[model samples]
Target: MKNELLQIGPVTIYGYGLMIALGILAAYMVVVHRAKSRRIDPSHISSLTIWSVLFGFIAAKLLYWITQWNNIIEDPRLLLELSGGFVVYGGIIGGILAGYVYCKKKNLNFLQSLDLFVPSIALAQGFGRIGCLLAGCCYGEETNHWLGITFHESHYAPNGVKLMPTQIFESVFSFALFFLLLYIAKRKKPDGFVASLYLLFYSLGRFVIEFYRGDIIRGSVGLFSTSQLIAVLVFLATCAILISRWIKSNRVSHT
Candidate 1:
């Protein structure tokens, strides 16, 4: 994996940053396209997207700092030395919060908006995982399996050793989920159903992935990594919400 994918005179294009940009663009396009189909105002989506991304980055960095608190306290300079450190779940939570606030302020249907955007989130995450692979950030533990990959010039991952390539596995899973969500959307499922499924499935996938994650700097709680803990919470919360909504719908239908 080459971090510095291209260099031109005074400018350099890094693989991680480039993939992130592409992910954002791709996600936006998907949102706009879906918005048109749903007859929702694309302008609102534009503004919401901006707010979500800005807050998402902030939250991701904030959570990363929190996880690395002890290290930062020991060596304050380490914070300045590190160019990048972010937790994906933090970004997801921050983005959802931002979108919720935006929907409330605009007086829009929040569930409908969620249904429109979650698939795109999965798509963006798919791209972001590829970025992680290229930058070698969320790498996997050493493995001698045929699927193992070795990175020679990774900024974070151990070089010259065969690794599990969990990044690719997650990327593939995200992409598959994106398509599945889109298919579920076309079936016109209940409002928030798609979003709930997204959360449930993503949390399960992430929790399982944490086992293979090699980076121990991400911190932990009890027997689980920070992400794993968050995933479990998200999964349970989504399940509870889904069950409540189903019961409420049933009651309304009966009445």
Candidate 2:
């Protein structure tokens, strides 16, 4: 739950910011390696990566502001604080849209690009969860379980007690998903299959994990968590996409 990693000559480096930088670097490396394998000009990926990350951050902040509209209205300055509160789903939506547009303009296949990007996104998210753990945000409800973690002096912690450590749980799950996607990629499944599977699995993981979150929660219709609402929508959308692809594949097989 330590925010400040070190101080040097009156300058303080925040753990959260460091973790984000590391995540971006790790994602970039994966993207470059993937581009090389596909024989796509790596420079195109480099350019698209910049746009994706820039838009992703803006979308993440915007979505967080929307979620915490009351707080932002009370203190506009809070919007500038990058320490926490960013939403990963918003970032993914924004980044994917930006990347798709860029790929279309360059005459690249959108599904192939998405297949290359999704695993890296999962890896980055896994790293970002570590940041959440260190920054003491996105924590879990108190528990007597052996996996409990305590963030005693952090802003995200309501009570000075041990909690379920949901951040680490998500991180481990995402890391496993990352490897699974990489493995599935080698199998040469349908172009968009890996990305669709990524969305399905990630949304399922998020839906389950949101139940254990101890932070302030927003409700949608009928006792549903805000994230749960979004997850359900995304899950349905993913199912539609998978079904459409299956139908197309079947038609081609019959042809």
Candidate 3:
């Protein structure tokens, strides 16, 4: 759980940040390969990847600041400490919005682009979670289970005891989702179908995983966590898209 991966001179590389960069690079490679296979313009993949990373980082920081506004206002220095603090939901929302706008401006097929990128996003998320594990952030509650991982002497670990390895669990889950989506991609289904399924499943996974997290809870509305609130919104949006597609398909079939 050591945060610093390496230090050379005045520059110190943090494991979390390094892992995030690696994840983005991995996702970019996957997207490029897929784009080539689909006969889509491969050049657009680089542009999209760059935009996604830039916007995604901004969104993550913005959302984290919003959630911890009181602390951030009291101590503005927290912003300088990029070793920790980021919300995945914000990145997803921002990346999708940016990608949609980019596709529209270029007169590209937005749904198809989303379908192509969904799995790559999942793969990136999986690697990012590994970074979280190494940094000891996004940790889980203390447990005596066999799966508990100790993060003693870690800056991100609150207590010097073993805890559930929630980060690893999430990483594995996201990787599984990535492969599942990749397998489904071979079927060549509807335009938004892959993206919709990704949203639904990822939201469900996040909702369940939030319960294991021991981080400061931002309180919940009714029975839902703050993450669950976002997940519900995503799930509903996916459902709406699927329903609209179904209606359109039915009409086309009837005609």
Candidate 4:
């Protein structure tokens, strides 16, 4: 709804892009504030975040291309369409990889840096989902429920039909998760706990939400959508990390 928020002369501001820009700015500001509180150099975090985001965009686009490989092969123009078709998992993975490399180069504690910044990722996602809702990209299955929303001008969603509004649901969940992560971080939990919790909760939420998504363009793996498959793997991997960390912590305490 209202994808074109404003236009003057040859300049036009689109809803999705505007929301993304806001989200990135908000996330960076939060990270900077957090860095000051954590006693880490805000300048370092600023550089790391910028690098992670740039790589995250590349990863998101790359994964989107992989998913839509067939469509791109048929119509090569789809490859250049940058307005949509990003995979969240790809972005997450890429950001983590970028952060890891940056941490290695800067001699920063990888887990500590990860824990310090993970919450901002969720914060950014909250705004990103609102972008999705505005652009009507990640729509949900048709439903007669009261929570359904109708998008008349959505280029992606079916017009005149009430849909489940998965984008809003995810946005709310992301905001809540952002707050929860902040709370957990304030509690002074273990080094890796916050990062693991972020992965665990996000993966679980994404897996469940994938069931309600109506966009078949996202592709599937056997009985599950592509995101669902990735979610399961992420969840299991996170569980394994948590268990390993817990056991190691117990051993350290006992020793």
lDDT, candidate 3, at 48: 83
RMSD of 2: 1.7
Angstrom error of the Cα, residue 59, model 4: value is: 0.4
Better of 1 and 3 by TM-score: 1
- TM-scores for every predicted model: 0.97, 0.94, 0.94, 0.97
lDDT of 2 by residue, 1-255 (tens): 887889998999877788888988998999898788789987888988898998998888777778888777889998788756777788988999999999999999989989999999999998988888888888898899998988766776654788989899999999999999999998878788899999999999999998898876443446666677888999999999889878988999999
The deviation in Å at residue 180 for candidate 2 is: 0.7
Name the regions of candidate 4 deviating beyond 4 angstroms.
none
Clashes of each: 0, 0, 0, 0
lDDT of 3 by residue, 1-255 (tens): 777889999999988888888999898888888898889887788888888778987897788778788887899998897746888998998999999999999999999999999999999999999888888888898889999999865777675788889899899999999999999998969898899989999999999898888776343557776677899899998898889889999999999
**Candidate 4 per-residue lDDT over residues 167-219, each given as its tens digit:** 99899999999999999999878787899999999999999899999999998
RMSD of each: 1.1, 1.7, 1.7, 1.0
Per-residue lDDT over 57-99 for candidate 1, one digit per residue giving the tens place of the 0 to 100 score: 8899889999999999998986784458999998998998999
Instruction: Quantify all predictions' global Cα lDDT against the true fold.
Output: 0.92, 0.86, 0.87, 0.92
> What pairs collide in candidate 1?
none
Worst 10 residues of 1 by lDDT: 75-84
